[model samples]
Target chain A: MARKIDPDQREQHKAAIAEAVWRLVARSGLEAVSLREVAGEAGVSVGRVQHYFGTKDALLLYGLRLAQQRMEGRIRRRIAGLVAPGAEDVLRATLAELLGDDPDTRQAVRVWTAFLGRALDDRAIAEALFADDVELRAFTTEVVGSPLDAHGLWALANGLAAEVACGQTTAADARAVVDHHLDRLLGSPDR
Target chain B: MARKIDPDQREQHKAAIAEAVWRLVARSGLEAVSLREVAGEAGVSVGRVQHYFGTKDALLLYGLRLAQQRMEGRIRRRIAGLVAPGAEDVLRATLAELLGDDPDTRQAVRVWTAFLGRALDDRAIAEALFADDVELRAFTTEVVGSPLDAHGLWALANGLAAEVACGQTTAADARAVVDHHLDRLLGSPDR
Candidate 1:
């Protein structure tokens, strides 16, 4: 006999588990992720983690996808608040997310760099993480609507994020870098 | 009885050990690195590895520093072969290394990201990595000699390198993106 969970409850548990994954990854990279560890971090039983995500790979993939979605949603919500934002404004705001100023952003960037490290050795991870690259690149391209290289723009922001995450540079410097790139790409004389 | 090793032989042994570290890191990320593992990978005994590197942290730090030196040397050699290379030419050659087209470069980039992942969790790693960053950024700034952000340029290249290393993008595409940015940066109307 098993207890049935509502859809909302299931989603909550899943999100909680994913949040645990984030914390673990931020602290110790992707290699630290395991069912038991995630369960411990989430304050749930290993049985519950197993019931939701069958294997470490599945759990990791789920966490990666969920984080990606959350990041996208956050950027979109922020953009929505920009009153009558132009293409450059939107692009700048989007790239500005790479500054990793906030705690969430810093954790996300750490997880991302960890994933990139894993991707080098694991084809499955490479596939799972890069699958969305095309759509993400297309989004940047559409947002820019200019001759600038969208992929390059995304990479630049990512690099800055990595810099901030590794404590190599400050968020202010990262933001300045993004704004400077935008100034050149959008042909704006002023920031 | 202790045998005195020549300077060149000692340097060679250390380099061999460092190369082993790169291979393991490239294959499985930084979390996979350990003293015994590196010794096995280098075809040496554990005692020998300990004799050379002292501890896992020291081994990793040494490997990282050695990798940095090799990359700088490689880039410098390439620039040296250029016929009447200008500052922009040198910069292009430097950024081009991030395309990760070659095996060594790919392995290096993987190790770099692995270290970045570890840096998030370990302050010691973060300090070692960020310490060199100032010198690297200064070199780029001197090379650029412009209002354009040198740090941003390096980050852009780093991002593209991560893309190629993760199998998200091709070397040719990454090269094009880098070149496009270079064109804009140097105000070169022609490719």
Candidate 2:
């Protein structure tokens, strides 16, 4: 009889592997990530990890995509809880999410930064990363209204995230800076 | 008879080593920076490299500090050339220098980013890097005046630098954004 393969089980395994990769990235630099180390960290066989992700490039790409999706999902959930979310609220929430205050967000930022360093050389990653930047710019432009370009807004948010991640600025201070910028770009924050 | 070490030649050798490390970092990520590779790139013996900088940590630290000094020196020269440099002029010039459009500034930013990633795990580097941040904050605060905190300004500059380095935005675009922010903070750019 053929063995049964459960879809949920497979996803859980992939997520575990990704999580392990992220931990390694957070602990060491991106260079520390390898199939052997990831498998060891994830407590799985190297063949199993290879089965799930064919190549290190694919694994890394999946990890990057996963981090982006997790951040987007988080922003969506936060906005959903708002009684009546406005454009400014959406913008504020999105920037705040990128600040990477909490553990999950912090890990995501680490993974993102690692990939960014790599993207400097890898054309494919650069293209994908730039696409994300374009999407961010569009969303920021829509929410903030005219006179505020997405490039500037994106830079400000990312700069804040980098500072927060590097311990140069506290999470609260970063949030305050973002809020101040928002207030300047938009009107005074409601309430 | 023991050969006497000339001060100027020692300085030149160290600068060459640092430059090689910067090139390695710019081409690959921080992990590419090993004593063997650096010595090979610098066209010097590993023993000579170690004689100047004892370990990989010291080598990396020296490279980072050198990059910072080069940037500061460039900014100082630019500011000195201005007939009558105002606060806005100083702020604009400092930010433009960080944008990494030129070859020198581009290499500096790349090395700085690599050090930053490593600084995440290295306590000594983190402390030194934070000190640099503090110094930058003080300088920005002095130039920008009140109502604009140094932390926010630093984040904006770094964010812009990261974006420019990652190819998400052009150097000219980053400069415009900085000027726009300056106008908002301190009145419109004078002359």
Candidate 3:
């Protein structure tokens, strides 16, 4: 049975639930995310979760969207911070920022990877993510003056992110890979 | 109630259960795996799963171990099939084969990603995976003419795999990335 909660309280409750979900995903992986488990972790009633999400699938979708929005916002802010930057420099900075090992960036990457696991199964999320990927690639290409196709650039970027997240690459090395790829694409050996 | 099956029948049942589990994981990610669901998919009794695995966790662990072994076996076989090969060529061929879009390799990667998600929460699995990562990096470092440190080479290999899995880079593109990284590490002005 569900309870009739107040509107403001409900919004707060939803946010709380979402935060709990994020922590769970960050601490573990996507499989650790469960409606019942999340409710227990949040100190909220299962009925409240059901009231807000209706189903596990709905909750997952909401969480995924929220995560993506937060990432997009951060990237936009980073891009905005680069003052009068050449396209290549901006791209390099943005890529470095994304793959950095700072705590905040690490959390962001964790959330991103968790979402990636889901995106593999959910076509809606995959479509949205693929579009964003294309946008990111186009932006990078413009910045680097690269004639390579969006797919190539996106692959390189995404691959680098995965490697960094998996603890295989240091932040410095990831940045270096980006620099080299961009240099090759831009036809500038000096970059 | 657990079934009183013979040893041969039990072995067959375990294989069937593992196969069903693989299909579910590949189709929907690891979050969707459940013993009940596996039993249903395998057309077996729930008691049988309990009898064979003792617990859902056990089943998952066993299935993941099988997936890892299969991945190693495939990599070995692919390398064995090559004609005369240099260190650089062998490294590239082995990596390309692992990241290729072949069905077996794809399934192995999918299962690996799923297991990786769960491993974040499971300390035993996490330790084992880290140990495996160390060994893999050490082995890879010896190849490629020592063009990169263990960590750098491992990261490149991981990034390459992730890129291939996401359809972001072609086999040829992955090879190029490897070549570029090797060239940089080798301090070559021209490839």
Question: Which candidate leads in lDDT?
Answer: 1
lDDT of 2: 0.77
Q: Tell me the lDDT of model 3 at B160.
A: 56
lDDT of 2 by residue, B1-191 (tens): 89887899988999999999999998886767789999999999999999999988888888877877888899888788888887668777777778746789987776666666666567777776666776667777787664335667677778777667766767788788877777777778754
By TM-score, how accurate is candidate 3? Answer: 0.75
Better of 1 and 3 by DockQ: 1
Question: Model 3: per-residue lDDT, tens digit, B28-144?
Answer: 877788888999989989998999999888898777776677677877787788777656556665667666767877776666655655555575554544456766656666763
Candidate 1 CAPRI classification by DockQ = medium
Q: Following a full C-alpha superposition, what root-mean-square deviation does model 1 have from the true structure?
A: 2.9
Each model's fnat? 0.79, 0.42, 0.22
TM agreement with the true structure for every prediction? 0.89, 0.92, 0.75
lDDT of 1: 0.79
**What is the Cα-based lDDT of residue B178 in candidate 2?**
75
Candidate 1 ranges with C-alpha deviation above 4 Å? A1-4, A31-36, A143-148, A189-191, B1-3, B130-132, B189-191
Clashing residue pairs in candidate 2 are none
Q: Find the 10 residues in a row with the least total lDDT in model 2 chain A.
A: A144-153
For model 2, residues A1-191, the per-residue Cα lDDT tens digits are 88687889988889889999989988886878889999999999999989999999889888777777777798788778888887778777777777746788988776766676777667676675556776667777787664344566677778777667666678788888777777777768865
DockQ, structure candidate 1 = 0.64
